[model samples]
Target chain A: MKRRSAIALVGLTLALAACDNMANQARRNPYELPYGSQENWPVMPLATAVARDEPLKPPSPPPVTMALLERGRQRFDINCSPCHGRLGEGDGMIVQRGFPRPPSYNIDRLRNVPSQHFYDVITHGYGIMYSYADRVEPTDRWAVAAYIRALQASASASLADVPPDKQKALQ
Target chain B: MAIFTPRANLFMNAALIGAVLLGACLLLAIRVVPVIGYNTQERFAPEQPIPFSHKHHVSGLGLDCRYCHTKVETSSSAGMPSTAICMTCHSQVWRNAAMLAPDRQSLAENIPLRWNRVYTLPDYVFFDHSIHIAKGVGCTECHGPIGDMDLTWKARTLYMSWCLSCHRDPAPHLRPRDQVTTPDWRRTPSTPSGEALMADYHVHTENLSDCGVCHR
Candidate 1:
């Protein structure tokens, strides 16, 4: 009987120890895990001067390509169209819902600003807008900026801006 | 003198005990089985600050999961949409409806809406949305037909063993990266088989069940 009881005790201890493994343990929020973004990761140097009193332009505008613009359009529709409106008229569904109205991109103030300003706002956020740094990847930010610039130009464009070959179609 | 014979009394007591045991067993089946079974919850939809319908937004309006849960692809949590996101259209479309009063109040006070979480994991189970998304797991795999849900409930049992079943063999649930957010996506003959997807996504089964994979 003594031997049998000892064996049972050993078995129970083994079972309890197995249950004590890390998988069964409770973890806290913000767990220290691998593969997530880390603060120690290298940061890329700013490609454009920080915007202050004077507006700074990007070293060069991202090469305008159909694919880039398409990507920009999709990203903008997902991220910016909520507040900026699908056409960047500052009449997005959210704006209608009673959020603070952002200035229309078609406005002269926004149209005159360099593409870098848009990127800065997206990266750092402006006014009541939250920074989309985590949501919008850097390349996509540039694409969105480029797309916004196109939207601004198109908003105010005249028949003169249309290609001469395509002008007849409009007429 | 007695109301019944002793044998009859014994038989009656036995029957009473048997009925009690049967009732206990039924109670256990109702309460315990759902906790253990896969995708077997009774679909209890909790009340929320707003009656947000996933079906209306996702299926009717054709909004992508990423439109509101913006960080699903990049962060640990599938972050909730801010009140501003809700008002973007609500301010114009349903301007004065009583249903939108909470949203209007939240925006006016500049306070974040306290949305009740439907699906939550225990603190011990560390799940990352980005990793699962990058690994090609569809949103519907665990969320369970969210686009059809009028009011979202915890769809899957989310038991550890259920998680292990997928972690051990994930190919069957894997899909093309583009279709991860496509809730209605299903495997077709032309689509790569689970084994091919497993190879393409490089989902090695060996380390997936390791305690540290989720615990740490």
Candidate 2:
């Protein structure tokens, strides 16, 4: 009888311990779809669909502050640098690995393009490149355009263009 | 005929001693057993389809975590690289490697490759990658030295106590927001003090460990 009672106690504890019902609940993961469910496959919004979160107003592209540039650099490095290269020379790692080269930002054509053009291309991709509207937000798209302009200027910048205090570092 | 035999007294003593030893062992096991590597699943590499190595991709090639996990900044979950992201490089290099056969098949079939979650939190726990990242919690804070891991494994037990320990005193775990995704990031001399970073990130300790913070 003692042995039976001990076994019963063990069974009770095991049963109680095994109930992770509260922890698991009924939550479905964002990406995971359960079998037998009628959930549609997750897909990026088509070009015809609402792509840009906000209207691109020419009057107010967020003032190009240092913060904007910094954000641009970060977002550009993550999203564009793989294909566009760090310096925007179109020789990124992906290109080296055989993805078609994107136009160099230093090129006259790209340099002449307005920030609005850059913002538009990113919103709805250009040429072989797919739309980055999914990854980069609207404001960040402007930031990247501004950074691209900075990259273009740096390509033609001379030693004298550097600020005197910082010139020694470049030397 | 005696009320109690001397031999019975010895047996009683032995039984008492045995019971005390057994109780001590049970107490020790209760404390130690659950935290063992086997029970915790710490450092155990679950089998993956492609045997993708973080060491090869992260350390060897210097790929950023955001290279694939693009939604990490804005979303609760760090997005897994789609098959297209893998094929971006694989289509050019290693075009027909047997290891990447599943990757190609996944793309062709339009089915996502199922990756086993290394640090699956209980559904009740509201862990947001974006919040942790925005608040400057480095990946290595919980993920360990990912660059050195050939096959990713559970670095630490995702036990509630483990989560609360850091949530209670997060200064040590805080880093620069830029370095949040850097694996095995170490503090340099130039790095801000943990307290300074905590202040900069506007982290408040009071609500961090509240049960509602994680358990929703």
Q: What is the TM-score of each candidate against the true structure?
A: 0.63, 0.83
Taking all chains together, the TM-score of candidate 2 against the true structure is: 0.83
On a 0 to 100 scale, what is the lDDT of residue B96 in model 1? 95
Residue range B95-184, candidate 1, lDDT tens digits: 798988999998897666666666767667778999999889999999989999999987777778889999998988999887888879
Question: lDDT for each of the candidates?
Answer: 0.80, 0.84
lDDT by residue for model 2 (A1-171), tens: 999999999999999998776656677777755533656655446767853445654335889988989989988887888778899999887788677788888777887777899999987887767667666778888899888888888899999999999999988
State the lDDT of candidate 1 residue by residue for A100-140, as single tens digits: 78999887788788888998898788876777765677788
TM for chain B in all models? Answer: 0.85, 0.95
Minimum summed lDDT over a 10-residue window in model 1 chain B is located at B33-42
Question: TM-score: which candidate is best?
Answer: 2
Lowest lDDT sum, 10 consecutive residues, model 2 chain B, at: B84-93
CAPRI tier for the interface of model 2: acceptable
Query: In candidate 2, which residue ranges exceed 4 Å CA deviation?
Result: A1-20, A33-63, A94-103, A113-131, B3-10
Judged by lDDT, which candidate is best?
2
